[model samples]
Target: MDTMRDRFAPVMTELLDEDPRVAVVLAEIGRDGLAEAARRHPDRVINVGIREQLLIGAGAGLALTGLRPVLHTFGSFLVERPFEQVKLDLGHQDAGAVLVSGLGSYDWPAGGFTHMAPGDVALLDTLDGWTVHVPGHPDEAEALLRHAVAAGDDKVYVRLSVQTNAEARPVDGARFLTVRSGGSGVVVAVGPMLDPVLDATGGLDVTVLHATTVRPFDGEALRRATGAAGADVVLVEPYLAGTSTAAANDALADVPHRILGLGVARRELRRYGTMEEHIAAHGLDPHGLRRRITRFLDGAARGGS
Candidate 1:
């Protein structure tokens, strides 16, 4: 199965061929995959060398001219490095672009902390009116990419990751899909975190909801899963821990609800190791998820915080 990043070039190529208004901007990252696209559409496919800020600025400039721009880079450089450009050129100026990111969080642990960006979503959360898509599989990524390109001047972020689930869940790029149903609680799995969340919640009486488009948050779907009065909800994300807890709390503010957010911890692991080690250290593996999810539900059942 192809990774999400692997699907980007082909999808973008198709878009560039079909839509004359669609353009791509890069900062010397993932240029090899898009070389053919650049060859075919030299003016549309732009490479601004290592200038991450220029990449975003160019994309925003394209957007200002009524062209849809898709910007590509590692999550750290894509969002963190050019954040001011993103906030001003895009958000402030009302210029929309599709920011497609690779190497989510710790996909390449060997690349060190500089390459990791677990806080990308959280930082974007500070801004308003941005749609974020964290697809679990390449198929979903391709679909969301197309959706964003055709979105007509809406700010969108497509977060691509090397860490993918064994299978792709059907994602409409808008609402959350209900994977499993139960009465105990609801387990909302975002992006690639679905498989592990399913494994962790197996045999346990809890509803499992798969989320590919996380920006909208899908509070209605979550409310339906947890019932009107509210109940325990565990959020298993591929990025920062407790990232969506505030949104969950606001969604359930009308009733009594307990939420346990689980994902990559804020604390950095300085020792270089495999990505699996990073995942384990962050307690995102199935075993760790099961332990934490079970404990949280058990505690909630006992009327504890």
Candidate 2:
């Protein structure tokens, strides 16, 4: 399956060619893929080695100088490692950069927690007005990248993971699109979480709503989807568990709500294995999601035991 990260490099290269002001700053990730772009536009595509902090700071500096900058690196290093830079430089300084992060959550399970970033989105949410986009497919990633790069000074985060959906869907603003509808409850799928969520809720009576842009969440659209169904929402994210629980609550707070938040575990499992193993350990696999969702919705339907 082609990943969003795979398409990220080429799309960025295209951006570099199309616009001279478009610059890409990297920290030894995706360098090979963007080699030609770097060679052609050496001034635009720069590799700051392993200095994640400098990678972000340089991007901020570029943005401050009337250039649209983009920073790319592993999720953990990009968000967790140079977080101070992200928060202060780009965010606090009011400088803007297109942060294209790859290897989300347990995408590189063998690399262990050092490489995994289950809380990238949560960290970004701490800053003000950062647009977060988690594309389920390469096409969506490409479209969103173009949109963000051309957006001019808007802080944008495009998260890419190894897991991908079978196909691409239309990229809408922040409106939650219905993948499969039902009368039982609603399932909000974030990014790559769509495929497994669909599989998990396949046999159940539930409405599945897919969300690619999470931050600046379309609460209105979500409210419309919930309607009068008691606001039983299942938010399936690829990052830290319960990351979007608060957003869901606020969206459906007008009505009494029961939300089941599912994603990477908060506690460090300290286990290193395959991506599937890590996902299973976090209870994010299809069977596990189905069991957890059914259990929660069943209990909710019964008015809680």
Candidate 3:
């Protein structure tokens, strides 16, 4: 199976090929991959050196000239280093550009924390008019990209990862993916962690929600899903506890949510390893999550309160 990165590049290439107006701005590292596509389809890609700020600014400029610009770069560099440029050039101008941010979270293990962007959601979510999409799989990424390209108004930030895909049921709307069916409680999982959630809840009557879109969430659908699973809800995310999930819990005040998060001790990681190792180290492995969910289900069953 192709990784999300491998799958996404081709879809983007196809889109650029079919549409003459669509042009790609490839960062230094991404240039080779995108350049090959450009070569095959000539007239679609613009290679920019390793300048994050300039890359976005130029992309915004391209959008102003009636061209669709898709900017590609490392997630950390795109959001962290080019903060001002992205905010002023892209967000402020309401530039219709798609930012493909690669290696979200610890995807770039060898790149270290400096290259890891676990806070892209919190950072970009604050910007007005910017749509932050954290897709769980390649299919969702392709679908979301198609939607964003056709949108033609808002700025888009796609936080992509090399993580393996979860077996999520195809999403029909902008709502989250409901993994396990239940009428007792809801567990809202962020990103690819939905796979682990399903593994954890083997025979339990708990509903698992995979949140594909982090911003501009489908409130009506969320309410319906949580309501269907009763009032008890638990939010699971790889990010810090008080970020998106916390804010969402506050917004849905009527439904009580138990925010289960990665403990504070594992917040700023120092070592390098695979995603599985990191997840295990932080007690997010299937066994650990199973124990937690079992406890929650047992408690809910005992009182039915």
Q: Is candidate 1 or candidate 3 better by TM-score?
A: 1
Q: Per-residue lDDT tens digits of candidate 3, residues 279-299? A: 776666679778766776667
All-Cα superposition RMSD per candidate: 0.8, 1.2, 2.9
Q: Report the Cα lDDT for candidate 3.
A: 0.71
Superposed by TM-score, candidate 2 places the C-alpha of residue 174 at a distance from the truth, in angstroms, of: 2.4
On residues 154-262, what C-alpha lDDT tens digit does candidate 1 reach at each position?
A: 9999999998899888888899999999999999999999998999989999999999999978998999998977889999999999999999888888988888899
Candidate 3 lDDT score at position 273:
85
Q: For candidate 2, what's the RMSD? A: 1.2
The C-alpha lDDT values of all candidates are 0.93, 0.88, 0.71
Best by lDDT: 1
Tens-digit per-residue lDDT, 1-305, candidate 2: 67788888888888899998999999998899999998899999899999999999999999999999999999988989999999999988999999988898988877988998998999988889899998888888888888889887999998988888888889864667788878778888898888989999888988888898898897887787778656688899989989999988987886877888998888887878888888888888899999999999989878892
Off by over 4 Å in 2: none
User: What's the lDDT for residue 211 in model 1?
Assistant: 94
Candidates 1 and 2 compared: the better one by lDDT is: 1
| Global local distance difference test of model 1 | 0.93
TM-score of 1: 0.99
Per-model TM against the reference: 0.99, 0.97, 0.88
